[model samples]
Target chain A: MAHALTIHNLKAQIQDKPILNGINLEINSGEIHALMGPNGSGKSTLANVLMGSPEYTVTGGQITLDVQNLLEMQIHERAQAGIFLAFQYPVEIPGVTVGKFLKRALETKISGMNVSDYLKDLRTTMDFLEMDQDFINRYVNDGFSGGEKKRMEILQMLMLKPRFAILDETDSGLDIDALKIVARGVNRARGSGFGALIITHYQRLLDHIRPDFVHIMYNGKIITSGGEELVRQLEEKGYDWIKKEYNLIEEEAHEYSTN
Target chain B: MDDKGIVNTNKKSVLFDYQLNKTPKSSWSADIRKAAFQSYTQLSWPTPTDEQWRRTDITQVDIPGYNPFAIDGAHEIDVPDSVHALSLDNIMMRDTALFQSTAVPLIRKRVETATDIFEVYNLSFFNAGYFIYIPENATIQNEITIRYNFLGTHALASPHTIIIAGKNSSTDITIEHSINNNNVYIHGLTVFLHENAQCRVNIVQNISKASYFFSTGKVSLSSNAVLEYFEAHTGGSIAKTMLDAALDGSGSDAWLRGIYFGTGSQHFDLGTIQHHNANNAHSRSYYKGAASGTARTVYQGLIEVAEHAKKTDAYLTNKNLILGNTARSDSIPSLKIRNNDVRCSHGSTTGKLNKNQLFYLMSRGLSEKESEQILVQAFFEDVFSHVSGGTADKLRKIIREKISDV
Candidate 1:
């Protein structure tokens, strides 16, 4: 009821193929939530659909931030409304530098930061992320390694300073040091009107950023939800137990999974 | 000079009457002009059937009934002391043989090999032209700038320019092409960089939107000659430009960079050729362009390596960005490599802006158009980076304004 971000009956599809059957989730300000799931369980689909990616079609859903209708706004409108999604695969933009991207973003309607102050803050943020100051001059994610791309995503998140953020597998390709650095940024942004839905498969990331609540999603549906215990259960028993315990019949089973 | 220059009321073959009226300074220059005019008469204007002319149709250009020579005050060329404008000497060399003409060193070296119909036309009937002689071992610190202001509609202006950089000499030439009104113009250039010669030529073409333009360039580099050429095509309704650079001497190097932005039904046909004839020669050419509105751009480039030109290095790339549905771009990068012991590669990409890139930028607060402008500027970043600081900044400002206009 008192959530900064809320989603109800979120049904979405890509290329007319329904992926998110009905995703219901909520995140309160200053709280961190973890959505754990197997690969291709509509986790990324929900993230993209929420961020208003043009590739996906939201058939039926209501996504709101502090009572503002999100589904009706444009892709950037959602960002200006304090919603940020750290992409699982950040697009590489040749010729656009990280500094330019951050500068433009900070100067947008939301942040309204000026040039000198923005640059100073950017340098401080860059230093905190353990990124070279020269990295800001390089093209946005162009020629960046997997770990560097993820770190760049986190760097943007720190600068944007959104109210509610959805991080899609930000830990997938990071080393231990990078993982710690990213989690530290998240932890630092935790209490300042910031809430996040951290999407990941393994619980190793949970070791760094302690999730207030844990969710188990299977086949576009969240089958179980609990506090921290769900992560321990899923980690120890694996996903097969959840599938069998819930008796989730194969929804249109195929001979070979395309995904 | 009448605002309407040399208006031939007799529409039936103004070519004959025009040639008869303009007398050559010397029998030698007369012979060259007469031979060129004869060649022009033998070869009529190119039809659409020609391979090179297939994409562009210039038969609609009515060359007759219009002025052949530039109006009275339009072709006033002011040359510095370091530059020897050959108009006077050409008059003095009229009696000399073709090869023995005192201007031999100031004339063409490698004839236009890809002789399209237009190059031949320019060579034959060039009414307004000049030959520039950069004295041997003469180093001119400041670049000489020549800006052509072709005035009058339906006017026929064919200008031929020959820049001869003598042995062991270094110079820079910047030619800016501009037109006062709509006209049909054919321009040609023959540049020879002799042994140990170094030259940098910057060509800026921003002709009027209602005009038709055909331009060709032939540059030959002798052993140890270094040539750097940069061209930017920003204005014109219809334009076709071809530049051919030949590395005839070993240790010679050539670098070519070009940028073009077309919009509002504009048509650009750009082509380039890098010919390697000697061993250890190097050449790199890159061209980038942006098309919006109903504009269409066609780019074709070739890198030719001779059979014995081993150890040659060549690289070519063409990139185009389309801004709207009606905008179209075609890039053709081909190689004619006869030598097995050479390094040559070509690449091209023609497409609209990337959706992912667009989304990525918009997510950070830039409007759709602002994001596109930024990306388009960034698209030409590599090419501009090769240019001088001042020239690059000037181009950046111009491109930014043009992008906003489109």
Candidate 2:
């Protein structure tokens, strides 16, 4: 069976400096995967590349979503194709209301829904996220708090109803309560037809939104993959064990060459 | 060499002689011709040395040796549907059969409204125009739109328009200036809003690239009257405009907004002044311009609060967006506040697009061109939102086309 999202040997760089080096990953339908790594391990870079951010150039690779070539589509087209990214730092679009922006995005996606029906769906999503009705009238993330911003990201994901989503550090600066609310919103989005790849540096979020698999990234590459236990082990022992293991493998390879 | 010919035979003989030969002495147009001839000779064309014209060069304005076209039955005008969308019961369509049939009487009455020397001169020389009048306590629901189309080379066209809003009444008017072919265009207008009346005016100048166009508007406001004006200029080799409003009554208000976009070798100059004479009056002005290629733009705004005009409030702001290395813009915002206990301020800024904004939009799915268009539209949203009527939709389309061209 085909995967919902697939990245094959993706090599990307920023100003001649390789960031995502031969990275490969795939998420099947209804699967939630957590990608955890140390600082500068290219976790954010992977998410940005998947979203086709112009800031990072893909030197070589292929990213496909449900048999569609993701690399060839525009950012908005990728979004309309049911691929959504809950940015770590949501951008503020002034003079545009949250409700207005959501309606426009939904219209761009569906294109045939009338204003009344769109508003009805939006009100339902807002209620599901436990968001205040007043939030809809405010400018998109203009003066929203960190927690509010995170909730808004989830609100969009819920409203847009994308097939595949990449949540990049959604819990970075959130408090425990805010993190729980964000995880609840994400969990609500997960079902038999949805798939997600959550990028985080800590295992706290994993405690709330349990992942089907956990991937450990080191030096811009995924070195290990395991079940939920992997996150627990990495949280207790940290990435030092993974680094030593890779070092030992390198030493073994060097000795064999010398012999 | 007859006495009649010699009497006009001076260094400026060609000016009046040409006027007299082209117009009959007994005709109403002859009076306008003589007045314009005298004003043309008496008031020399504004020079670059003048303070108001310091930033704009008028040497290439094409002022000499052109006769005004006479309004005749042969001159057929096709009124676009968009122009009629702003029709009001009190406002007559300038090109309708009824207006065409009663053109002589309308012109006579419009000529009689001009008592000022310069206005009288314009009246005497005006050939084709429109007259609009609103009765007391009568409000117009739609905006009145007038379109002037010129279609020949070296042809001089001066279309005069007069608007009168009666006491406690309100209405909106839009005047569109367009040229189908290369030509010389000169136009003037006078508007009067009575006590407690309100009027909104939108002027769009989309002349031909090869044409030289000049327009002037003078407005008088009564007590508690309000005027909102917007001007959009995008074409012409050399376009000069002057808008002056006098707040003659207490509690009157005026708001002026303008936007100009120029490319190639186009030169656009805009001047505006708000004269406050009544107590507790208020005024605000905002003008912005975008110039690309070798184009140049100049904006001058003045807010004058009289000595006895206490409790007055006024503000003026001018901003420019420069797109190319050779494009230039000059902004001058001045305030002459003579009264105490009044609030007044003026500001001006000139800069290019924000790099961060461009990158932000591009990162979200839009190309560089699309990003620029969004930012430009966002910048002008405030001005366009204030515009009410079908004309707003048309103006939006025109701006969109211009953005795509860029």
Prediction 2 TM-score vs. true? 0.75
TM-scores of all predicted structures: 0.86, 0.75
Give the TM-score (0 to 1) of chain B in model 1. 0.86
DockQ of each: 0.50, 0.17
Q: TM-score (chain A) of candidate 2?
A: 0.93
Model 2: residue B87 alpha-carbon error in angstroms? 14
Which lDDT tens digits does candidate 2 get at residues A1-259? 3247999999999888888889889998799999998777788889888877878899998999978998998776777677778888887665456775576567666758799887887888888777899998887687899989999989888888878889999999999998998899889988877899999989999999999999988767899999999998898887777778667365533432343
Candidate 2 positional error at B230, Å: 1.6
Query: Which predicted model would earn the best DockQ?
Result: 1
- The CAPRI-style docking tier of model 2 reads incorrect
**Best-fitting candidate, scored by TM-score:** 1
Please give the C-alpha DockQ score of model 2. Answer: 0.17
Q: Please list the residue runs of candidate 1 whose C-alpha ends up more than 4 Å from where it truly belongs after superposition.
A: A1-3, A110-113, A250-258, B1-35, B65-104, B108-117, B120-151, B156-161, B166-173, B305-315, B332-345
Give a tens-digit lDDT track for model 1, residues A1-259: 2357888988988897888888888889978999988877888888888788899988997988877999998877788777888999999887778888788887775455678888898899989989999998999999999988988888899899888889999999888999999898899888848899999999989999999999888778777888998888889998777878888665532211237
Give the count of colliding residue pairs in each prediction: 3, 1
